[model samples]
Target: MRLLAAVDLGEGLESVVESARFLQEGLSIPAELLHVVPTPYFEALGRRFPHLRPGLEEALSQVEKEVQKTLADTGLRARVLRGFPAQVVAGEALKSRLVLLGQRGTGTLEALARGGLARYLLHRGEVPVLLLPRALKAVRRIAVGLDDSPASLSAFRVAEAWGRALGAEVFGLHLVSGQGGCCFPTYLDPETLGLADVLARAKAHLESLLKATGVVEVSKGDEELDLLRLAKAREADLLVLGSKAKSTWRHRLGRMVEVLSSQSSMPLLVVPEATVW
Candidate 1:
């Protein structure tokens, strides 16, 4: 599959390159290194700091050149593009099977805050997007966070497909956060059903849904430290999540998809809730 690695010339460019290299080595997908120039205001800032601007641009350009050289050295193909980051990335993403992006910044505070390129691609990209974290060690297995929702099923499908392609194991994790205390009310108590029963049903549902894919290993867990922790414990190379647009700001903010994106170390594969089979 053709993997488009979005090399946003942000602070995360180095991490993006590492991720692209990892994907190329692990999955053997042809990768294209893409860069997006900043808008006019940022361009003016660059002009003000001429030395710094040239140095930074040179570093970024070197990254592109290095990636191209590496691909060529390995007998793989690569492409480089420059334009508005989001727009250019979106355009290239359309031509690729999957789009890869790195989490915005290196600082912990910046990662905690919103508005990063990784988060933007997760929320906005039309194709399946993978948000690579700065600390990704290797890609051995993929973990999929599953619920009884259609979006979750879609996420499972994507993860399974990717795992199959890479000859990697797939861990299907279904997390159930017990009633009350920070979780939404609807998720509380399982509506007269026993917690064990609810979990069992969820596991059964995942089994049935994934029966045809044979490559996935399904399991259930309690939602405690978020899906990120579970993935970390499993040493997952990727985490699959699902998102649905919500009206309430709190709901949107507390969304599992966003929560996973903000905190997870493994790359995330997000599929829209309304995505059709």
Candidate 2:
């Protein structure tokens, strides 16, 4: 598979480079390096202010040179392109299997609050986008957070495929929130279950799900924190999670998802839970 990684020369540029290297070595996919120059206004500002422009240009040139040097050093081929970052990267994504980017950028709080290019791409881009965490060292295994939803199953399949391809361990994780709100718990109440009995039954259900998948390394926890902790404990290379069910555009931008998205530190492969594909 071919992958396109956008290197913005922002704060996480080095991490992006390292991730590209890892993807090349692990997935055996050809990675193309893309650099997006902002629109003409920003470009013109840098051009008109000769002294100011030189330093910025020089720094970016250095990054480009370093990227090329690293690719050559590792015997990987790379290409550079200039345009609006999100648009260019999204366009490139249409021609490739996956896209990669850093978790955040080097822009001001206002710009970042507005959402970085990576966030934009995650919401709108067609292909799967991998947002590299800031602290990744090496990817040894992949973990899929599974639920009873079709989207979760899709993510699990993708994680399994990637794990097999990379010769990495595949882990199935199911988080059972003790709060009695979701559908699963409601269904269990009909069977005359107490809280403790409900958790036991949930564990058994998760076990059945894992048995169906034939993945031996299955883990279940009661809290999101516990799931993340288990992933870290296992030194997982990737974490796959399902997005919420479909809603209207306004509801989609609600607070819960925003908070959850802000908290994730690993590369979150979010698959729409209601997606048919």
Candidate 2 residue lDDT tens string, 1-277: 5777776556777787777777776777877766665545646778888667877777667756775665555344566655576777778777877777676533457336535665665566256667665734565688876666555566676777777667878777655454553223334663476556765665566557556634433333454556667777778878876554344365342222344355556776665444322
Off by over 4 Å in 1: 8-11, 25-28, 42-82, 104-109, 112-114, 135-137, 180-191, 212-224, 245-254, 273-277
Compared with the true structure, all predictions reach lDDT values of 0.63, 0.61
How well is each residue in 92-203 modelled by candidate 1, as lDDT tens digits?
A: 7767767777775446687755346555555553567777767344757888776556676777777766676678887777666655533322433566877667666656
What lDDT is reached at residue 227 by model 2?
A: 60
Candidate closest to the true structure, highest TM-score:
2
Error of 1 at 208 (Å): 2.2
Backbone clashes for every candidate come to: 0, 0
Q: Model 1: how far is 157 from its true place, Å?
A: 1.2
| TM agreement with the true structure for every prediction | 0.71, 0.72
Clashes of 2: 0
